[model samples]
Target: MSDLPSPHDWVKRSAQSLKVERLEAFFSGHAFDAHKHDTYAIGRTLSGVQRFRYRGVSKNSLPGETMILHPDVEHDGHAGSASGFRYQMLYISPALVQQVLHGKPLPFFKDGVSHDPRLSAATAALLNSMEDELDPLEEDDSLYGLVTTLQAVCGYNQAHGTTHDYAAAALAREYIDDCIEQAITLDDLAKCAGRDRWSLSKDFRAYFGTSPHRYMTMRRLDRVKAAVFAGRTLVDASVEAGFFDQSHMTRHFKKAFGISPSRWCLSLGE
Candidate 1:
């Protein structure tokens, strides 16, 4: 219907290694082609009924309900009503979940949807409008809260393992933070933390929710964003931020943030 809002229009926001993909869209009919990705697709229906197929079962996500599609699962989306559906979703990496759970099995929502109030509240914080900007500390708090809520809602109990070396991971994290612009290596991190390379890698993921490389990538991405905000060209920003080229930066930018640098700049309406 001409009067129906087009779902093709959407906006997204994301950062570097944390890679929390946020989207707000309105779909009047069929959406995707039953594809799958390596991130958890969690969302809340904002208006109308969202119908979709998940794990070979037809399901409907009504307003105020949470939709949790696990990583690498096949799914498709469509509107359940003529009125269409508007929603906000966050595509979170399972690695981030592992950070909180310490390498436990990923949580599964059997029905692919839920009415859990804790999930609703937790998702709401991270799934805020695409226009919102979350500072680093605020983002950390929100991410921890969300992952904890998800663990509870999914009925997962974290397994106790050989304790991770927090001191080593923290030292490496600090080193990365200090030398963010340089191309860092696993050996560099291991030496900095006084641990073996593989062990430090595991420890870094356990403590920080991402790999050391991803962490550095995100830090460079932060610099790119700052440069753009301060009125630098994406080209200059990408180079100054330590990317090989604008195209290389663009690829990572889109992959991490779910939007091109040009589109993101336009969203600022400058």
Candidate 2:
């Protein structure tokens, strides 16, 4: 009859892709150190109290409440009560959100937690159990709904007098995808996009919600994940993914997903 988590902490990762990573985890005490992510972290607490520090304030997300952490924001997490907390989270690349909003600014939730039923409904499909595999179309529809619902909840307004070179950004993104396993630079992306380096950098962020460098890095991480999932050793996978070594890849992996590659693999019982 206790709500407390067991002595051991555990995480279960579901099927993931370059665009989204999903996991369900339980923690009894301190869960994460101060860290920032380049992708939006969105989730719902399933039991007990999920506590975190965001934007200089402490917040708690109870069961059925949604927590939204914007990209590149510093935060830390822990359980707010003796009972600990269990939650399901999805890390979504900003580029996917751009696919729906088309170069708009990413939505922000100042409070870091939401009690809105609409947001919960929108995330339901994508937040299903780790054992369930979402159909491709179903996932896409859920993503669209989530993005639009976020905008609605935030009262998003279209900014005027701002323009982005979507063509250039798209060209740069394509080049990154094609050469993800190679060393890339701003100059390289600029040439590929037919624009100057600085301007292209700005445009890339405007359209994709992240810098060209970050985008390339995430793509490389995606490669690393795939190779590892296919049974390759960490060193081999890191090298094949264009990382200098396993340690190099591990740092980025932890920052991006809040868990190391080894832990992530173990979570899936692999």
Candidate 3:
């Protein structure tokens, strides 16, 4: 398919969870501006040529190829061919990765695309059907398989000398979850985790793949999304989610998901 019959773009999201967010989307022209996410953006292009810029290099993911974009990496998306692109993406929280890998640094795929059969199979188990809700145990098993496959594909060494305080980071994460609707400071996290602020910040990033503030913001965004999906207005959702206003929440929403809140709601058929 070298040419798209229509130029319309759309996104369809699966059931939302803090551990992962799944979506299938198609775009004919520009898909997204440069943006960064705090979760690993792993996906497979189903048709056409999915193209993006990552690590200062332009890359294309052909049909059935796995694209493993690292957390917090700046990238953008568009169709590499005129047919446009259709794909399914799984945005997994690094905290969940840490649950399986312990305190190790998140697995890295220097090149955004991978051809490993193990990874392809593992991702297919998760992305094969967006319409069906995964059973809780089935979801856990799939995530475990995917994370381990990613580690193997990346050739991560278990003996890398990097040390992370997983306990401290876990404590800090719990505190953030408990206080997500309030202003959170590094000092607050440090006090809760019983670690020094700076060191805890480092540990948090190493274990969670994002800063404390970013994690807190993402959690709040999750709340906003839930509220909006429950029929609350954008302004009300923002306020309830602890953002100053809808515009403030919108900026972070775009930065994290590469789409505005209103656009995202429309994609949900709201």
Candidate 4:
């Protein structure tokens, strides 16, 4: 067996309301535990070599390579070099992904890792923004661009396959907007606009760049975030946003924005 180093040999810096964290360490170490979240853990290896396990398989991330960890999977992390590992992780919500996809079906990347240049480039832009102060509009524009870019990279073709006769995804989008507080399903979205679930999912992503489920979560987060900005308690915000609880909302909120919603609110002095 390969002997691992100490777990304490690590350093972490983060902005909490958002789920993203910038880590640089010789992590002569390991993760605290094998844990899973309700968000996509997307990140880049900056220096040395980073190693981890996902979906029951071991993987290595070289510098400039992006590591995509789907939410709710058990995984562990460690360094492959004496220099340790350096990386920034963006915890992405399925909902935010859906925003780009509209009400479309979710696209699956068969590989756990990707070197696709489009995804790489778009990811770099957002990761880079972590270092700067951004206005909501500026951030939204960049985020929207990246989301759409990712859909394209994931093989969402606007001109082909599946939804050949569906109406524009606009109706589904409107239904989601109007029914933000209710429980919705793929079948519901398809029925809302007379499209098949798969076609609706496809058009949602083709038009907005993410899946229906993901879009709903993101929209809910937006409300949760808005409530936070307005000074509602986390519990209140979570319930209002349809999250199971504050902890659930916190996980998703941090995943989407890179910091805990509470801390983020504090940072804003609201």
TM-score of decoy 2 = 0.88
Q: Write the per-residue lDDT of candidate 3 for residues 68-98, one digit (tens) a residue.
A: 9998888999999998999999999888898
**Stretch of 10 with least lDDT, candidate 3:** 1-10
Question: Candidate 2 at 90: error in angstroms?
Answer: 1.7
Q: How well is each residue in 1-270 modelled by candidate 4, as lDDT tens digits? A: 122324444434343434233333344545333545555677788877787777888788888787777655556677777777777777666556666665664454545678888778777866774546555575567667766765676775343544533254667877888898898888888888898788777676654545667667777987886787688887998999888888887766655544456545544431
Best by TM-score: 3
Candidate number that wins on TM-score, 3 or 4 = 3
lDDT of 2 by residue, 1-270 (tens): 122223577877787654688889898887776667778899999999998999999999999999999877778889999988999999887778889987777788888999999999987778975687788888899999999999999986546876668889889999998988888889899988999998898888766667888777777888887887799988999999999999999888777655667766665562
Q: Residue 145 in model 2: shift from native, Å?
A: 1.4
Which one wins on lDDT?
3
Give the poorly placed runs of model 1, Cα more than 4 Å off.
1-43, 48-62, 67-85, 89-113, 125-148, 154-162
Query: Per-model C-alpha lDDT, please?
Result: 0.75, 0.83, 0.87, 0.65
Task: State the local distance difference test value for candidate 3.
Answer: 0.87
Clashes of 1: 1
Any runs in candidate 4 off by more than 4 Å, and if so which?
1-26, 157-270
Shift of residue 114 alpha carbon in model 3, Å: 0.5
Q: Work out the TM-score per prediction.
A: 0.63, 0.88, 0.92, 0.54
1-270: candidate 1 lDDT, tens digit per residue = 122224354544444324576767766676544655456788999999999888999999999899998765678778899888888888776656767776555677778999899999898888764576777787778889988888788885445765567778878878987887688889998998899998988877655556778777766877898899799999999999989999988777655544567766765532
| Sort by lDDT, top down from the best | 3, 2, 1, 4
